[model samples]
Target: MNAPAYAHPQATHTVPLGGARVAYLLVRSRRRSIGLEVGASGLTIRAPLRVSVAQIESALQEKAQWVLDKLAASALRVQQTPQVDWGQGAQLPYLGGLLTLQLHPAAPRGCELLAVGEGRWVLHVPLPVDALPASVRGQVHAWWLRHARLLLTQRLQRFAPDLGVQWRSLRLTNARTRWGSAKHDGGIMLNWRLLHFRLPVLDYVVVHELSHLRVMDHSPRFWAVVASVCPDYTRLRAELRQQPIPEWDL
Candidate 1:
C-alpha cells in the first residue's frame, strides 16, 4: 500500500506533520527563536540564522496543532469572505449599513451617492449597466478612496482635539496586516479598507493611532488614553476584528 501524498500550491517550503501537509515560507533572520505567523497567505516561519532544517521541523511538529488550527481558521475566513460584483444592486458594507451600487447612464461620468431610504444609500455610477466590470470597479474604487480620505480626515480632526494630540500628516494605506499605525513624528497611516467597518470601529482606530502620539507603545497608559474617549473600545475593537471586509480583485 502507498501512503497519502499532499501538495502545497503556493508554499516555498513543505513538510509533513501529524498526518497532514504543512506549507510555509521559511525565513532565516537574526532572531533567536522560531516565530510562526499564519495569515491569509498561509504560514510563515522565521528562524534564527544558525538553525538547521531539522530544528525548524521539530519546532513545527511541536506546534502542529496550533498551526493546523490557524490554517483552518484562515481557510474558513477566506471561504466566508464576500466578493464584490460591479453591477447594479450590488451591496457592500458602509458605515454600519449597506451601500448598493446603481448604474445611471444619463447621469454623468462620475459616481454620486443617493439616499434611497433609512440606513440605506445608493452609489449612482455614471456608466451604463453594460459597462465592463473592471471599469465599473475602477470608478467605484476611486470614489471610495476619495471619500475614505475625506471621512478619515474628518474623524482624525474630531478626535485629535479631544485627545490633545497634534497630527502632522495622514496617509491612506492599503495594508493587509495592520489597520493603522502611527510614527513618533505624528504621521499616521490608516488602511482605507477600514471603510468596510462601522463608524464606531473606525473611530476606535482613529483614536488608537492618535493616542500613540502621546505614548508610542501599547502600554497601560496608551490604553487608558483610548478608554478615556471610547469607553466601549474593547467591544468595538473585537467587532472590528470579527467583521470581514469584502474581497475585491481591483
Candidate 2:
C-alpha cells in the first residue's frame, strides 16, 4: 500500500505497518468498539470516547494486515478510476458513450442538447470559453439532475406496470454509497449520479428497487423478482460495479 500523501487535519496519529505508513482519521465517538474503514478517502478510525491512544494503536496493529490490504485495493481502484475534466472540449460518459462539451458564450446561460453523433454527443453550454471550471461543472451538474429526474420518471412509468408495482413518489438522491433505495411506503429515491450509466443499467436499478415493493429483503426470492423483469440483471449489476463514473465534487 502506498503511504498516504497527506492526512486530514483531524488525523490524530500515524502508525507504521510493515513498509507502509497509515495515517488514519481518529474519530472519538460513543461507539463500543473501534471501527476501521478503508474507502476512497483512505483510512478512518472510530473508537469510543474513553479509549486510550495506546489501546487504539493496539487495536489497529491487530488488524494491520487487513487494513493494509484494503488500502492497497482502494488505491488501485482510485488509480483505475477516471476523473471528470470540467473544461471546454472535455468529454464525459453519457448513455454508454461520450458527450463532448462545447462552450457557446452567445447562447443561454444553461446547457442545451446541441446534437448527437455516432456513439457521441454535443452539449452546448452557454458559457464563455474562459469560464471557470467550477462554474461549468455546476451548470452541467444541474442539467444532469434535471434530465435524471425526467428520464428516471419515464423509465419507472414504463416498467412499473409490467412489474405490477406502483411507485408513490420519486426523489433524486446524491448519496455517495448507495445507488437507489426504496421505502415501504412506495417512495423511491435514486442517485442522480446514475445518469453516468447506460439505460440498461439504469433500468436494472429501477427494477431492483421496484422489486423491493414485492420482496423487501435481498433474498433469493427478491432476486427472482428482479430476474423476472431484467433477465440480464446479474451481468448488469457487475457492470454497474466495475465501470467507473467520472469523479466530481458537485
Could you say which candidate leads in TM-score?
A: 1
TM-score (C-alpha, index-matched) for candidate 1: 0.79
**What digit string (tens of lDDT, one per residue) describes model 1 on residues 29-110?**
7776888877666778888999998999999999988888777777788789999887877888988888999887876566
Clashes of each: 0, 0
What's the lDDT for residue 185 in model 1? 91
In candidate 2, how many Å is residue 152 off?
A: 0.8
Q: How far out, in Å, is residue 88 in model 2?
A: 0.8
Instruction: Give per-residue CA lDDT, model 2, range 34-74, as digits (tens).
Output: 88866666788888999998999898888988988877877
Every candidate's lDDT: 0.85, 0.83
Off by more than 4 A, model 1: 1-38, 43-67
Model 2: pairs clashing at backbone N, Cα or C within 3 Å: none
